[model samples]
Target: MSVALPRIDAIRDAAARIAPHAVVTPVMRNARLDALAGAQLFFKCENLQRGGAFKFRGACNAVWSLSDDEAARGVVTHSSGNHGNALAIAASTRGIPAHVVVPEGAVKAKLEAIEQAGAVLHRCAPNTPAREAAAAEVQRQTGADLVHPYADTRVMAGQGTLVLELLNQAGDLDIIVTPVGGGGLAAGCAIAAHALDSSIQMIAAEPEGADDAAQSLAQGSRIAGITANTICDGLRTLIGESNFEALQQHGTQVVTVSDDEVVAAMKTLWRELKLVIEPSSATVFAAVLKRPEQFAGKRVGLVLTGGNVDLEALPF
Candidate 1:
């Protein structure tokens, strides 16, 4: 069976559904960073979003999309970090339970936040199959809905709302870039961005070590089973099937950057933009720096995906 992708209408509905819950995160600019990249950059500060990430938008949408009866059974999902925390928080607002199947060795701060948000945590081996199996078991046991971190259409529509807000805030961007993990955010952004203004370019910034999105796009098939070795823990997952389909449909472009470059860009954002974004979030900035010719003098919108860094484990 073919997967149904989120469309512009669905994304618009999501914007309305999640409006009361999600933040209209600020758009920031730094003259110094603009000069450094030779581009006019607008940073959508999702670092300051609720749950400290854009993951909340999708999670909130998924949680609330359920019927009251379905929500009573609650929601379950697998995540390295951000999505779990977002789901937990989103579920709480609706007075429902949340079961998160988190990988072993997932970010400590994120795990703590998930628990703090009142979600039950299930530990799994740090791999895709293991995580999915654990989440399935939880869903089977609890009769909860499985909100696949990126693949679910509702989740993708929720993620797309960010671009809707970005375009409304930043007006007439030449390019919009987002970090791609399971490709939910990028795919969603692609759908929304193209619908609003097909002239605007949509780019996915990826870690070179976990470049499955790039490889998948290049091969014209969803690539799987590559061991992710990036320091960006939030972005180590393979691209989701539905997300890949959306990307293919929208002709989204992919750009890869190294961990060293990500760290450099993270520091630059902290120093220049005063943003405490994590490694995964820094990939967009690193991509621009990596390919200045593509962005130079253009109005580039960068989605700073999250700010959930383990201060004690700073890469610098």
Candidate 2:
């Protein structure tokens, strides 16, 4: 099960491939956040990225990586929200059709955005197996290229592009933190950051209720079938196989935080940084706040994965 991880060159290629479409996304900072965390915190605001999440980077790369014939046949994938919207928008850019298999209870706003992007939506049970099966059926019928949300190498390479932009913008960072769901962003960041600077540490923040990534890393094996019961809806997925392989290869660290802690952190970011981010994005700050000693006096970079929150349901 030796998975070949995306190399720095592949990330560079992805960056070039997606440059015309993907946003570079700003790296921001707040002195108040620094004071509270006892560290210099740099936030990579992918919430402002097109389609409102860092998922666009991976989705765009995956969509555009296809050959002309593949593009003509179009793309299909299963996503809870952000990735679906991203794939839809990305496919639209190439003037191709996109098929998104979304769970029945997916956020209304996200589903609307996906449809608005002109992608046809297919609904299934809100579980991994059902989602995958529906997406596979779509591909079988439409003769579409299946673009997995996170597991594909092209998607990983696209995600790695975010690290490339972050390191360049933030300069030397001691550590980079991102919330882990399917482990796409974390794996990509780990690969790119380690390639750029071997000493740079990569850390993943996970919801305590969905701590499979943390447990898997600690036990030296992938853990599955744990029911996710966290407020961070976007992070309730089991880690992807290749993504786990990348994390293990890079020796990435994982920290778990409770839903309450995520809410508190989310509130702090909204108040201090004036940013509207989802609970999944808040996990990075929550992790730093939970373990101050780990990041004290260091320059830490946090990826605000998305801002696709339901305005009607404010956790604060």
RMSD of each: 1.0, 1.1
For residue 257, give model 2's deviation from the true position in Å: 0.3
lDDT, candidate 1, at 286: 97
Give the TM-score of each candidate.
Answer: 0.98, 0.98
- Model 2 spans > 4 angstroms off: 1-4
Q: Please, what are the lDDT tens digits per residue for candidate 2 over residues 64-134?
A: 88999989999999999999999999999899999999998888888999999999999999999999899
lDDT of 1 at 194: 93
Which runs in model 1 stand beyond 4 Å of their true positions? none
TM-score of 2: 0.98
